[model samples]
Structures are given as structure tokens and as C-alpha cells.
Target: MKKEFSGRVHFVGIGGIGMSALAQHLVHCGYAVSGSDRQVNEQTEKLQKIGVKVHYGHSEQNVKGACLVVRTSAVTPDNCEVAFAQKNNIPVLLREQLLGEIFDAFKQRIAVCGTHGKTTVTAMIHHVLERCGVSHTAFIGGEYNKSNYFFGENIVVAEACEYNRSFLNLHPTICLCLNVEYDHPDCYKNFADVQKAFSALFSQSEKVILPSELQKMCDKAVLFGKNGSVQAKNVHVGRGTTFSLYSDGVFACKCRLKVCGRHNVHNALAVFAVAKLLQLPLLQVSQALAIFCGVDRRWTLHPECKFNVVCDYAHHPTEIAEAVQTALSMCKGRVFCVFQPHTYSRTKAFWQQFVTCFDGAQEVIYLPIFAAREKPQKGVSSFRLAQLARQTGLNAKYFSTFGKTAQHLSKTVKANDTILLIGAGDVNNLTKFL
Candidate 1:
């Protein structure tokens, strides 16, 4: 199907980050875009401001007179609009299929994919391109500089998600594969199933860039990490991070980032490798890297709070550990972690890992799990998680709601203490109480 289409295009679950970005892109291209969601939020409001018609709730009529209907993976076939579209013989497309078409239109396409850090790395690349005055379009997974969709010239930079093997849809000119790990248990049966998807991605791409550890996955890939083709050595992490970047065994330049963490150091290295492949100016790239603040909810700092409070989207076990460590490294006082598990399947898959991840936190406050699209699983819950954590010798407590959690923190937390609100769901809303 053609990327460019006439007539109205409707999106089911348009409030989603990826869906909103795509809708924004289509609107910019002059297509009549409409979308439906259960409720109006930031994404829908932004679309409304830009003249994209939005419906509050889904209905059969919502899909009427549309050239095509695009639905997020969460939207089942039984959805009213989706059913209507099919009954009326209208073409229906998955979100990723449409994204792939849009991506295919670009002459220079970069698709960044991994279990973690895709959003930050994608945004970093966007900043580099913007700083260099390169004409490019970017679809970031999270809001960067307060926007997820940036329209520019032909070059396209997109955050490729691995869930449901969605990243396989877009055939990119350059595929930046960050470290791969087991995730999306609902989609993949095992770790090897996850690796198989990345291998397929490497096979279809013209160029592949990865960390030194994953070099064995792709023979033609360029490597980044310690002792790789591109490296960030002598790392220093505080309010921010600085490192010496070396490319192909030669010193390239010193890089500094406003974002703190060794994970971000690896993220920057991936960006540097992409810059090198694109033949961008290293000096300018380093400067751009220094100035990039970071994406929203990825260690987002709330200065209004009496104490330092950080809001982060770290749901996976590996991510939780890294985020807690990053918080511990920067805070002079005790670190208090307020965690909400993202999905039941994930929590059940990595139960032990989750219990042990908050090793260094002064206290772990657990909220109800965010069951995004899954029903509650037996023997999998935040309460059990807290119990396991306590058994592990970590101070852990379970709060059934946001109010109680906030109340406990307000009484116990003191000056200089840091509160970390960590999750992938609505748990971030706890920030209003803090």
C-alpha cells in the first residue's frame, strides 16, 4: 500500500505515544487524520490543537467514511471501529505496517531498536541531526523536548519497538541494535525467540550498528562499547556524565551529556557510531551530545518538590537496577524507591530479579501493578514482591493506593532525601502528591 493516501484516516487508540506520533506525521502531510480513544489526554489535545479531529470514545460511526483504519496492537478485532471498518470493506492496517510504509518513503532511514534505551538513543540522534542543521524527521518513543513527532526533510529516525516483533516491519538503511535482553514475555516464548527477531532485523538492513558484546550477532555490524570499534572510556557520572570517545582505536573527542548514568554512556556511544557512519562532524556531534537534556520520564527531575524527586519509566528488572543505581550515585542522601510493576506477565517472568533489583535503596515502596493489557495473574503482585524484597533484607512496604504511598513518604522523607517514582504506567501520577 502507498504511504501517501487521500481521504480521512482514523486511528484506534490514538492517545498512545506511537499512534499520536504517526497521526501527527500524517496530519503534517496534509492527510485528513481522525482518531478515537477512551479519554482525551495530552496526545489527543495536541492533535486537536493541530486540527486532527478526535473522538472521545470508540464507535462504529467513528470508522465511517475513512479511507483506512489503523489500530494499535492493544486494540482487538472486536473493537467497534475495527469491526465496522472490516464489515464495510475498508482497509485496516496495524500501526507498525503504516509506520513501515512511512519509513520506506525516506531516503536515509535509521531505526533504533532494543529492549531498553531506544527512546533516549533515538532522541539523542534527533538532537545531533537538529544541531548539525540536517533536514530530518524523527518519531521518538517518548517525548523529547516536549514533543514526540518532528517533521523535517527525507531522512527518518524512528524508535523501533521489539514487542510483537514490531521492529521487523520497517526496513531501515541503518539499523542501530542496542543490547538485546529477554522481554515482552507475552510476545516471545524465550530469550532465543527475542534474539531471533534481532537477527532477522540485521539480515534485512543495509547497515547494522551494535555494542561490542553483540558483535557476534552480526558479522558486518559496527561495534560500540568498551574495546569495540567505538568506545566511551574514563567515564565520570555525577549531575551529568563525561567520557572520552575513541573510534576505531583512535581518539575522536571528549563527550559530555546532561543525562547521568553509564547506560547513557553506552547510549551516547551508539549515537556516536551512527554519526560516524553518516559522516557527520565529530566536533559538532560532541557539542550536540553535551546540550541534549534528555527525554521525559527518563530520570526526569522535579525541582518543585522539597526534596529531589525523580520520575522514570523503568519497568524491566535490568532497567530498575540501573535506574536505582543511577539514583544512588547522584544523591548524597538516602534514596527511596517508589516502584510500580508494569505488567503481570513481565513481573511473573522476572519475579526474583525484581525482588533483588532494589538492593541499595534506603526503602522500597511498592504500589499496585499497572496491568496494561493483561488480567491479573495468580501469585504475581506488588504485595508479594514487597514480601520477597523484605525477605532479601531490603526495607520494603506495600501501599494499595497512591494516597497512602504519598502519605507514608511525606512523613518519613526528609530534606536531601531523594524519591524515585519508577514505572511504565500511571504510577507517575504519584508525582502530584509529592
Candidate 2:
């Protein structure tokens, strides 16, 4: 894949954030990019506006005459485009494989991998490098105001996903692991299996960065904390929690973020760890933190109405709890939660955990589970979660509809109430409608 090579490349699942970013990258590099998704949305519209051909539904014609095809794990072998590409001898590559091929051009490839916060952390490192006018390329999961794309290939930051061991495809110079936990039960059978994938990811890096808590899943990885080698200290959890970065042996300067949560401090620290690895000045990393407005929909503030409408992608119980507590701390009033549980298997597996995660909220509104890849389970529904919520002594209500729930939230929440729309799926979009 030369910089001048512009081949007939088509993406099978093109509208997703990751796939669309890849297509956009190819277009920037002069490749003729075409893609097919099951549905049309903003990302497809953005691609079309940028001169990339995109179709609403997948078809064999979409893959025909293409020199190469890019597919995702969600794209099954039976997908018409994938099957057609395979049958016609067209080279088909997965998203991760394509990333590995693209980053081969960079002198220093930095990968951020973790069960959580990889997107924020990767964007953070990219931000610091970009702000200093260091030419770098980045492929993160979210569009954080934190950074932009590369200029002269000084650094290339990529979010290493752990799904199906996808991160393994990329041999990174620097890797991160943010508390690996049991997830993707459909992909991995149990907790040990998830840890094994993470352990393998940790072992491959030239030098790894991890929080002190997950040191058990790893050893000898670069340690970071409020007082670790590459980290922030004196993190006063005032109104919104302020902190400063520390490099090899010097405390750079104090910095504050518009974003909330101790997790974000950890997120920023991961970036600081990589910056130190590259010998970037600690002051540059601290300045980037102040400029970060936060990733889209990751606690994007909505201070328009009486109550602030915070949107986040906290589908997992642990993520939800963290987001809720963060929101609660910021709100002088009460924290109202409008949560849509994601995936049927997740809802069923962690049914009891969801009930208790709302402890930080003043009230809880449960929406139907967003069955991403799983068929809906008969018994495992948001209704069951609402039942459990009641048993936990929280003011809970189950709404099978997002519209009704949003309306309810608008009417019920008092002035200065903080409500977070938490989920991985379309639930966050409701905040926009509000």
C-alpha cells in the first residue's frame, strides 16, 4: 500500500465509526472508497458528502470489481459482499488487518488498548503530540476535540481493540490496558478468556502502560497513578477534580479538564505515559488536557435547560456506575439516570449488578435493552431490571420507549437536576432531541 496507490477498495460495514474513519483515511490518501452498511445514518451521509460511494444495504454488486475489500468482525462470512469478494478472488481484509497495513508506514506506531478508556487515552496522546506541532496520525474510537490527524508521521496513535483478539494484529511499540474485565461473553466464554486476550496484548508491546490495579493481569508494565512514574498528583476532587502531570522526575504543571471522573485522570495519565516514552515535554501533555472538550457523547454537557443533559456511552455496569458517580459529583442537585441496558447477554449476565449501580442516582429510568448483536432474551428485559431496581430501594421506573422516557425526564427533572443518558447504543441520541 504505497502512498500513491489508489486501488478499488470497498468496505462491507462502512458506516460504523471505525470503518468510516478508515474510509475517510483512504479517501484522504487518494483511494477510491465505496462501502455498504445495513442502514443509512450520519456517518454514511458524511462519507457521501466527502465523495465516497456508500450504499444503505449490502449487496454482491458492492464488492464486485473491487481490488480489495475491508470487513469487520460483525460482518459474517455469509454477508453478500464478503462472500462475493471471496468467490471472485478479491483480497478481503478485516478492519484491524487494514490498520496494521496502514500503520506500517509510520516510524513509531503507538497503540492504546484496554477494556475501557482506550478511546479517550489514545485521543489524549494524539492531542499532546498534535498541539506541539508534531506530525502524527491517529485512529481512535471517538472524535475527541483532544486531537487531529497526522502531518509528517512523527507519531501514529491507534486504539487497539480487544474484540476477537483484534489488538493482537497490531504489534505496537507502546500498549495500554485499563482494567480488563469479563466482557463480550458472546466472543469469550468467561472472565479468564478475556484476561488471556489482554495478557497476550500486554506481552506484545515494546513497553506497556497500565494502572496499578491491573498490575495483577500484567507485570513490569509502565506503572501510572496519582504518584506513579508517569502520572498526575494532588488530584483535588474539587467541583470537577483538578490535577497535574509528572514526567520522569519533574512535576510539569497543574491542569484541569472540562470532563469529570477519576477514570479521565487515568485516561489522561495513560497519554502522559506514552508522551514520556517519546520524551515529549510534560508541559505539552498538561496543556493538551486543558484544551480537551471531551469525546463526543462521552459526558457531553447539555446545560441548556434547567437540568444538565449529559450523554455517555456507559453500557456496562461498571462504566455506568463510574459515569453516574462522576455526574453526581458535578451536580449540586440530584443525579437522575436514564439508562438503556445494552446487549441481551450482558443484561442477563449482570442483571443484579445493574440494580445496584444506580446507588449514586436520585432516580433511575430504565429503557429497553439495545440488543446489539444478540437476539432478545424472553425473560431478560429492562422490565426485569426495573423490578430489581425497586428491590434495591431506588426510585425506579421502566419505560419500553426512549421517547416516553425522554419526555418523562424533561417533565420530571427539576431545575439544576443532572440527568445522564447512559448506554452504548442510540440512547445517547435522545439528549440531542432534548
RMSD of each: 1.0, 2.3
Best by TM-score: 1
In candidate 1, which residue ranges exceed 4 Å CA deviation? none
Q: What would you estimate as the lDDT of candidate 1? A: 0.92
For model 1, residues 1-434, the per-residue Cα lDDT tens digits are 25556799999999999999999999888899999999989999999999988999889988889999999999999998999999999899999999998998899999999999999999999999999999999999899988999999979999889999998998999999888999999999999999999999999999999898888999999888866778887889888799888888888898889998989999989998999999998889999999999999999998876667999999998999999999898998999999999999999999899888987999999899899989999989999999988898989999999999989999999898999999999987888888
Cα lDDT computed for each candidate against the true fold: 0.92, 0.79
Tell me, by lDDT, which candidate is best: 1
Candidate 1 pairs with clashing backbones: none
**Poorest stretch of ten by lDDT in candidate 1:** 1-10
